[model samples]
Target: MRNILTLAGKDFRSLATSPMFCLIAALCSVMWSFTFLRSLILFAENTQATFNPGPSPTLQMTVFLTHISQINLLFVFIVPALTMRLLAEEKKLRTYDLLLTAPITATEIALGKFLGAFGVILILVALSFLYPLATYPIAHFSFPPLLAAYLGVILVASTYVAVGVFASSLTQSVVLSVVMGLVFNLFLWFLSQGAESATGLYMTSVLEQISIGDHFMAFIRGSIRLKSIMFLLSCTGLFVFLTQRVVESSRWR
Candidate 1:
């Protein structure tokens, strides 16, 4: 446990020192904030124009959903930047030998790295909360759905991070890892969108059942379906398992 935490801490420090992290974080923060602020202004303007007795729960829900919906796009660009170095940098610097040869197990190493990256992601996600918090006075947002929406953000962001970690494990070059990460994430995200167009009714049902986007919607709508949560967690576990296997294979060679 201590070893895992220590390794995670080391990863956190490494990311903190990297200019790439700074660039990506600054870029995402600015972009998301500006977009959120713009949306708030537009929503407010529209509400005033409508003269529909001001803010209702329905209005709040729609605005919140619309705002959270775009977060996946942010994750698509930033998650790759955040995760490309997890294992790939080890190989690039010839540190894999030292890492694999250490007393720590591959599972521990993977978990530690995931936790480290996730910690940073959580901080960024929290930073994004500023928009909602700032709007609380005006929107009078309901805590239940709002909290659930944040959970959706974390889960969806985590899905991207998991794919990025697996992609990084497959290559020594961070650029290649980032490219692969984007491809893998876009594949899953697009599939969720494409599912509805399946040829047969049964196939469509199956696709909808597995649709990442729909599951995310469930969270945004304040429905904590066990199946949807499990699907995301299973995906995370699968990638983490694959990453550990990658490390284990390289260690034995």
Candidate 2:
């Protein structure tokens, strides 16, 4: 346990000092700020303009979910930047040989790197809360759904980080790692889109079940479904496991 945390801390420091991390973090801050403000303004306008006061706008759209979901799509670009160096750079600099020789297991190394990247992602996701906090007096957001939406974003982002880690493990070139991460993430994200054009119920159901977007909606709407949570956790674990296997193979070779 101590070893894992130590490795995670080391990677986190490495990531924090990198220029790419700064770029991605800055980008996330700018985009999320714009989206949060826009969503809040629109929600306020719609509330004042409407004759019927329906469900709480806070509940209706949930401030974070309103635009965060779209910003979440940017993970395809941002996660790769964050994770491309985890293992790839280690290999490129031949530091991976030293790392493999150290007193650590492959699983520990994989999880540590993942947790490190994920820590940064958590900071990015937390940026979504700024507008909500600034506009709290007027917004009067509901805490329950707001928190639920936050959880959903974290899960989705973690899944992206996991995929990026796996992609990083596949190659030594950071460029190739980024490309692979983007392609893999794009496919998983859009996998649900195929359900619409499917000719058979089985195909449609299968796609819907595996679709990240489909599961993601339930949380954005402020409903926590057990299945959705489990699916995301499973995806995250699967990729981490794959990364560990890759690292293990390299360890033996």
Candidate 2 off by > 4 Å: 52-63
Candidate 1 residue spans exceeding 4 A from truth: 51-59
lDDT of 2 at 83: 93
Positional deviation of residue 223's Cα in model 1 after best superposition, in angstroms: 2.0
> Worst ten-residue run, lDDT, model 2?
53-62
lDDT per residue as tens, model 2, 147-176: 777788899999999999999999999999
Q: Can you give the TM-score per candidate against the true fold?
A: 0.92, 0.93
Which residue pairs in candidate 2 collide? none
User: Residue 208's C-alpha lDDT in candidate 2?
Assistant: 91
Q: Pick the candidate with the highest lDDT.
A: 2
**lDDT, candidate 1, 151-225, per-residue tens:** 888988877777888899999999999999998887776775566678888888787776687788889888888
lDDT by candidate, in order shown:
0.81, 0.84
